[model samples]
Target: MGERRGRRGREGSAVGLEKYWASDPMDVLRVRQDFVLADVDTGSAPGFEGKKREAEKSLAVGAGILAGLQEQLFAGHQMGDDPRRILLVLQAMDTAGKGGIVKHVMSAVDPQGVQLATFKKPTEEELAHDFLWRIRKEVPEPGMIGVFDRSHYEDVLIGRVRELAPPEEIERRYDAINEFEAELAASGTTIIKVMLHISMDEQRSRLLKRLERRDKHWKFNPGDIDERMLAPKYREAYQVVFDRTTTPYAPWYVVPADHKWYARLAVQHLLIDALEGMKLDWPLADYDIEEQKARLATG
Candidate 1:
């Protein structure tokens, strides 16, 4: 595909190629924009050891940014005038590091104000209601951050990919998702959706590592293999979702997950951009410290 603005056009370029070179590096590194840089083909690194090392380095940098953002958020809550809520909806196949991100990226944030919800297969009760009913209950309250480990997008992404629903049903969902997200945006919830993209080979290797290691055995689910087998179909489903749903109100970010650290960094920067854009003001208090000090002296 032809390149526009130094990055891949609409159709994403290879894994690491997009946005490698930018006039101002940060200009290419935007939170809500599409990228089209050359791919960095870091072929299998000597028995996967090199890949692990690279992944760790990227993850560390991302974690650092996350920690810094946590601090900023804490201070903002205490000393700043930001009242907008930030929500992160992480959607990916199993073993895509959703939990790891919660553990590492969010470890520093105050738990009292951060909510995380993990959605799995619908229960008999959940299926009984509209698809979004469960998700609606989990929306973050004011003065809090809500994290959806998996969210309403499943109605479209996984549902269509697995052929769990008919084509007409899938088509109907596109508008529903838009209106749902639009309502959230209109209501003041700043929604950020992240799709973690990992290569098929990387996923297989990660699954194998989980099976071979005793500590990781708990993550070994037979269903994971079945989902991995459907990557191509999932990719197609995502293409449709992305094309239909990437709107000004609620944009979707497709993050490269092979490098965990890089993903974290991108997410951190994106969060910062979103929060900073809010132009938050500190809440006003009735009493004035300077006036109170004067009154005390007079008394």
Candidate 2:
């Protein structure tokens, strides 16, 4: 069940979803295919409640394995002479469970080796600099895993959605992003961008449930309602962005997030697959074993 091999159980499990599972890849795909689709109220009863429990257990087990593999990367495993750097970026609409995904997916990684940056609205300082400045500060160092909870993509997603920048400016920024990502890839960073796709109904249900549960009420933001109102606009913006920006060097995975469990599993599997190919070997120094043994014998 180590992270490298944990995904074997669910490589195609999504393709085999049963009707009672409450969520299916095909259903989520349909929602995306028809962007004009209305957001229904799935909160009355979680469509996949029965199947959710089993999925959760599977995800927990998979996450445990992934953590261990991440440890191997930290331990200085190398594929040939090249050490690897992994930068994972998770993007999603409101309440698509970005935080939850980070918590569960990266739970096992060593804290020092993993840095998580969650980007919200730009600050005065961040805005003062180029869009990539704040992001540049968060890139993973060699032999580390960096997780950007939101990331530079916002300059494309939200900026375009709100018309914060002009058309020419937006076109220029996409080229900037492509170059930035290409540079990261060329420098040995494995850049994986994930876009978590959640249905409007699912989001609405989550928002309401957050309101009903006092303990979770803190997560309820009135602004989210406004964002929900802008859902179609955002989807249009995302579709355009996806088409222009999904690169071979840094591909985008549109994760079906209506089922949080499935979403988490898909990401974990993808990450594990990327890392397994790395085949890291522990880094060794020049010390001779015989000399070390002699020193030990002297002691």
Candidate 3:
């Protein structure tokens, strides 16, 4: 589906996102010293002033720009020499729409250029290694976009809330993660860490809907209710994560995710912004185009 976009997508920036966005998301959605998860209105769309209709329009426009930019990055990797890549780290509670972002926003680019990794329970082998051992193996190669469905932060989030590890060991992983990401950034990985923030009430509604529909029965997990019971602790764990891991090199953006459309659009803009910052150009042809054209004509 996305392959055709590479052939005719626009090269210019999609300005509607910039125009409708009230300010840089970093200034609004990024964690601040005074930021509190409880204070965030889950339904609110921070940094964007546009309504759903306008946002839908902006999303369509951005898709073209995103597709074209991805083409350039992929070209640099497969056909030319380029070292830059992107790692979009997504952390959220169940049903926060991580899969939706992957489907709706990332579908604009060719699948070959996108690498997706979902981190679930560690096998006995993975458990024997350090927490990041498996994660490091999934890092995207040059000129590709990498996504983490649920990432290393789960160690601190679920780990702390459930007391899976000793408190001291959990503490150590925080610094370990920071150093690991800094190293990746130095090696030319553009890291975008995002937390999809959803209200407990909204979560309840979604879960109820899943129960009502036969099709959604497969998605419902009774364990989710058990997890929901510990929402307060999870929120506190997330707060600690923000306090320690949010840094200049790999900052976190807590996207309000109650509205699935807004969350998708916001993440699309974030990806576009990260790619735009790269300032990459389409790789020039290695062969002489004129010579090839002349040879074809003579034949």
Identify the candidate with maximal lDDT. 3
The runs of at least 3 residues in candidate 3 whose Cα sits more than 4 Å from the true structure, single-residue gaps closed, are 1-15, 294-299
Steric collisions counted per model: 11, 6, 0
lDDT of 1 by residue, 1-299 (tens): 11211333345342222222122112333233343212322131211222455545544544443444444554555554444577888887777677777776676466876888888898999988878899899988655668999898898878898877889988988998899989888877888887766787778888999999999999899999988888878877777777788778777766666766555545554664565556444345547889999999999
Model 2, position 151: C-alpha lDDT score: 90
Task: Report the lDDT tens digits of candidate 3 across residue range 1-299.
Answer: 23433332244333444667766675677787766778888899987878898888878988988988888888887777788899999999888999999999999889999999999988899989999999999999999999999999999999999998999999999999999999999988999999998999999999999999999999999999999999999999998999999888788999999999889998998888788778767788999999999999999
TM-score of 3: 0.91
- Model 2 C-alpha lDDT versus the unseen true structure: 0.73
lDDT per prediction? 0.66, 0.73, 0.87
- Could you tell me every candidate's TM-score relative to the true structure? 0.75, 0.81, 0.91
Which model scores highest in TM-score? 3
Q: Indicate the residue-level lDDT of 14 in model 1.
A: 27
